[model samples]
Target: MSAEIFDICVIGGGINGCGIARDAVGRGYSVCLAEMNDLASGTSSWSTKLIHGGLRYLEHYEFRLVREALRERELLWANAPHIIRPLRFVLPHHAGLRPAWMLRLGLFLYDHLGGRKLLPPARSLDLHQDPAGKPLKADYVRAFEYSDCWVDDARLVVLNARDAADRGAAIHTRTAVTAARRDGDCWRITLQEKDTGRESEIAARLLVNAGGPWADRVLSLSDQEGGEGEEGHRIRLVQGSHIVVPRLFAHDRCYIFQNTDGRIVFAIPYEGDFTLIGTTDRDYEGDPGDAAITPEETAYLCAAVNDYFRTPVTADQIVWSYAGVRPLYDDGASAAQEATRDYVLRRDGGDGGTPALVNIFGGKLTTYRRLGEAVLDHVEDVLGARGPAWTRRAALPGGDFPVTGFDDLVARLSADHPYLVPTHARRLARLYGTAAWDLLEGGEAALGQHFGADLYAAELRHLVAREWAATGEDVLWRRTKLGLRLSEAEQNAVADAVAELRAALPNRP
Candidate 1:
């Protein structure tokens, strides 16, 4: 088949890919994004779910990465106040770990290194008197509290992709790039739709390999022979996993506990009833797609959390789990935890300056926006004058609502949609932002069968129509995290409803 053409072709639909696509489209570049699986179905969703500079990165003397991430933290918080909120982490200084004074020094630099604005600075805390210390053991008397932001990483990626589509970018999910070859100044690429087995081709002026852990594999498939340019630049795949257990402590604050092995773990309040803990950094040598929390990893995470929390948790206490492989730029670091989280964008063109493929290396959710801007920076010279950077100030889709405060918006929503329960009202406000109005049409009159916990036909219809929610899992997990709250029977009902709906549609894909 003849290939359709675009200005840019972005591979992968994770945070970095979506961010780049969003920025590229907004800046007047025609973009086509191809994802082999669901958006954020990779490491993006499996993040620690916090948008903060790694305090430990400061220990590695990565001042630039930390400052950039810290700066982006506030920017993201201000932009997505509903989904992203400021979180305070209480660090209990254990005797064997880095000395309390050293931690305080690190926090001092963390506060001042980045331009401190809305978020509060770190302060010394006495575990005996401070309320944030009640959960820790008596021996852990001295501690420190620092500020950071928490983001729904999956939603962040989806929102970027949504905005990209809104700005004329074509986002193709369940589409894998089968081949990429250089045809003159453009790249001729073949994409196979995973669901339909239909093949289509697209030509673009530039190609981007943002395949996260699978970046090398994607490069190996590129038109460029043998992935030669990618030889020297190898990505170290590290597996990190998290475990969810019943809430281990009280208070809205999160705990950052230092483990005996020099690694740190977070025990944060998840949803309303669970505590999320984990992240074990282990070297991975297999396929990124098959990465999962093995029994050993699970036991390690459980033991890590059990070491810090006064109330010990075991494998039986784990309610759920997830794992992801981070494609870190290999610096030959001996330990997985020692690997740099900094991202590198390499332009792959010859000495004669042909427009080439840009490959993205390691990056975190906190730095995705900046990373997007940087990717554009690298491509700007190649594209000449594509467009100016506008994402720094632009509001994402559903984030059009003014920054008047989330509570006020929730109250306003509650007042307007009187039928919606407080939880339901808040959930809608948090998920859809200003777009909640779009779903509330027909009000109670249009509402249909309730599958419990704010799952209604009104919202589901809106999701299917606007958010590209193809399957029940899309609605339950990505569009909304209702999967955590929905019962097994309710989940089955959702699957059945979606299946029925798909069957009824004349043009179901």
Candidate 2:
């Protein structure tokens, strides 16, 4: 059968791919995005969960990258204030690790470099007297408290894909692009569903390989070999891991500690109950799809945390762990940590030229919007002028709430939904933002039964109906982190409910 042709076909559903699909579709392009696993199932979810100007990147002189990221940080925060909140990070000054004056200088540049409006500027701290100081050892009396934003990474990807779909982009989850070939001036593509082995073929005038860590594989599978000039540029995979442990500090502010090896580790507040600590840089050689935290990486993270915190953190304190492989562009850097996080775009079509495949290399979560716009610019170069860039003001799906006045919004929701528990109300506000009202439309009258721990029928039904939640894990883990709070039997009960609910739906996917 001849496949339906699209203006753009995007492979991989990570932040970059989803962002591109969302951008392209909004600009009046017929688009389709395919992902082998769930959205953000890859490196997107395993991020340090920070939307910040990489303070460490200053040492490497990546000023352009840092400035762009810092600017986008404000944009993202303004767009999704509920899920992405301003987080103050305390950086303890160690004598040998980093000179206090040098750190201060960096913070000074960071404050003035990019237009920082809503968030507070960096301030000096006295560890001996400040409450943020209590967690640190006596030697580090001086610290710098700076600002960054925390993101629900997985939700970010899903929201982008959702927005793309709403703008008429076809999204195929659990679907992998097995082959792509340039046929005449159009490209032929094949998609295989992972679960059912169902295969579908399609034609696209333009292809985008935003395949994160497996970009090279996509290039190879498509029989598109890198040749002389720009098309030959490649991506280097680097692995990073994070560990979640019992809360180590009392304050909401996160801590950035410098290690002996000149690397930095973050101890951020996680899920209202845990401290998220992370990340070692190592060249990854294994499959990106199968990356997991090793015992050595776990120990390294624990040791890095134990070095600065007053309280000791052993492996026993860890409750959850995750790892991700970053698809960075190799710039001939000697060390893994020194590799650039900036993105590079490879374009291959135009005029009387062949259809293009733009492969994105190395980008941070904070910079996806800018990356998306840059991608559209590349697409325009090949396809001629299509549409003006408008994603700057456009909210992703449900992020339409007024940015500066969230307190009033929350209070209004509380007043409106008096039956909702405070925690559940806050959870709804956090998860759905302004769309919480839409999710609770049927209200207490329609809520049939409570499964356990804030898992109600109304919410589950909303997840299934609106959020494209396919399985219990998708509902519990990705849509909301309720899995950590739910018991095994309660999880099974939700699973049973999902199955029953799915069986009854006539239009179930």
Cα RMSD to the true fold for all candidates: 2.0, 1.8
lDDT of 2 at 105: 94
TM-score of 1: 0.95
lDDT of 2 by residue, 68-155 (tens): 9889888998888778889999999888877988999999989988899988999999999999989877777889999989999988
Regions of candidate 1 where Cα sits further than 4 Å from its true position = 1-3, 225-231, 350-355, 402-404, 500-509
Q: What is the per-residue lDDT of model 1 for residues 1-509, given as tens digits with 9 covering 90 to 100?
A: 24467878999999999999999999999999999988888888888999998899988889999999988887787777777888899988888779978998999998988887888889889889998777776788888999988888888888888899989999888789999988788788999988789998888888988999989878878855423553566789999999888888778999888888788888888877798887889999889989899999888887776666677789998878889999998888999999999998888872254657898889889999999998887677787676678887787776765554888888988898899899888888887787787789878888898987878988777766666566788778776778888998998888788766656652432
Q: What is the lDDT of residue 259 in candidate 1?
A: 84
Clashes of 1: 0
- Each prediction's Cα lDDT score? 0.84, 0.86
Error of 2 at 28 (Å): 0.7
Which pairs clash (backbone N, Cα, C closer than 3 Å) in model 1?
Answer: none
Error of 1 at 301 (Å): 2.0
Q: Give the local distance difference test score of model 1.
A: 0.84
Our model 2 lands, by Cα RMSD against the true structure, at 1.8
